[model samples]
Target: CSNKSGNKILYLHFDSLIIFHSITTISKVSVTAGKSVSIPCLYDSRYMNYVKYLCEGYYWNYCNYVVKTNKPDRSGKYSISDDKNQKIFTVTINQLTNKNTDYWCVVEINGGSDHGESFQLSVSSGKNSGGMKWCRLGRNCVTKSSGSIDGTTVTIHTTELNVFTVTMSGLKPEDSGWYWYIQIPVHLTVTEKLINSKYCKRS
Candidate 1:
């Protein structure tokens, strides 16, 4: 899972206790709507025996667990496993859809607050899983290399099981096209609406 391109970014600071450090995870994980993904959560070597779980929710403060390493078979769509040797646990979710986007990797700290790191699991709906490409002025185009996207400052990352994140910044009218897993296209008529979710509002 660590062997990905420059698209993923690690969060140095998380919303937890001063002593409770969260696990290391991919900055952005992208996957197809129907594809499956295994999310890796790295923890402190001292807490190898601590319980690990995968939770899902729009709000980080009230995340609902989908699976745990202690109870792997409790959920049919989700399961978790821990490897003390690696000091990391993996959470696997099958048959993913748009609803299976936001998630958190949590560790139950002893006699203190729990540690966790949030991730954005963007489940895109695309049939073409090719490398990124860029088009200028809806004309000439070029094949893009990883971590070298043009205009939109795009970053595409992939881990074991094809999970990735398509993060695009600096949107422009000309920066429109089908750029592999992550695409940014301009719409003729744009109608904006205020989102009620905190995540969306922050975005």
Candidate 2:
């Protein structure tokens, strides 16, 4: 994962009972439809040799298997790979749709608790609409050149949530507003009607 913000490592904790088990990962992840996303699941060093997999679904009881490290890419859309050296395994999903909105990173353990962490996969609505901008300020984004913002990506921090980042390729001319860290919501207006043309006759 590229750290545009260079924040500290984020640790995800379970409930008080399982607080001992901590998983390192990003708080939130965002991807565009028809695009692919690579999510890094940093596990404890102890799980270096364990089998890793990505499960898909909103609920833990129904999280169906998408891909496993032991299994190669049979579907050509989902894949898993382990980097034992870094104690990290990555899950990549391609051709994501709105349905592909939730997933979990799982590690298999025989006759014991299988460690896992959940995350939300937001399919950007503006990604297809052509307004894209990366969140460089962590929780606050301000642009004064333009009075309004068009396309801005919002990512929820589900884990440690100390630092969250959303990346997009393009920036719109009008996407200038403040992304307040707190209760302030975004205010953007699409301006397809603002086009100026001299072809029409005056009434």
Candidate 3:
């Protein structure tokens, strides 16, 4: 097992069969609706000559290519650039909207396995940003304008400039993982609270 650029890899073996699974860190990026955001993707030096591209979709295998180092998007909504010397590529998404969801940074390989890292994108309305939704990846979402989910409450008012908060009451160990507020994604971890035995009274 190893961690690379926020991606966690694990290997499972069943007899002679081996399975590889990866869990990527879903970063939260707050961008106003109709605004633009640039994301940087870093790859191994061995893939310097490989084709770098940006793909959009909730699933890795089904993601559609948005932009590539060789084929720049002509729609002007997406752009990509690569820096071979630094082993990094940058992709810019312009005029973002709620429709923009999950994305993957990928390196193409011929006759071999391709490498990719996935991230989630969240879009916030510049006006009336009070309404927000909380969601787990590939699952249903709870909206502040409607109701809460599993004791999770979202603050209907903006706490600060372009900032909102969500409180998940009675968090359990299973609640820890990737979640999103509208288009913004965050990784949450829940651990058991330890109490000092010295404070306990004998029954």
Q: Tell me the TM-score of each prediction against the true structure.
A: 0.54, 0.54, 0.52
- Please name the candidate that would achieve the greatest lDDT relative to the true structure: 3
Ordering by lDDT: 3, 1, 2
Residues 18-53, candidate 1: write the lDDT tens digits: 222557654346678887777666678878878988
Q: Candidate 1: where are CA atoms >4 Å away? A: 1-21, 127-203
Q: Is candidate 2 or 3 superior in lDDT?
A: 3
For residues 6-71, could you state the per-residue lDDT of candidate 3 as single tens digits? 345454678843332322223456677888877666577778888988989876657798888999
Clashes per candidate, residues 3 or more apart or on different chains: 4, 1, 3
Error of 3 at 128 (Å): 12
lDDT, candidates in the order shown? 0.61, 0.59, 0.68
Worst 10 residues of 3 by lDDT: 17-26
Residue range 150-187, candidate 2, lDDT tens digits: 44544433234334343322456344322332212232
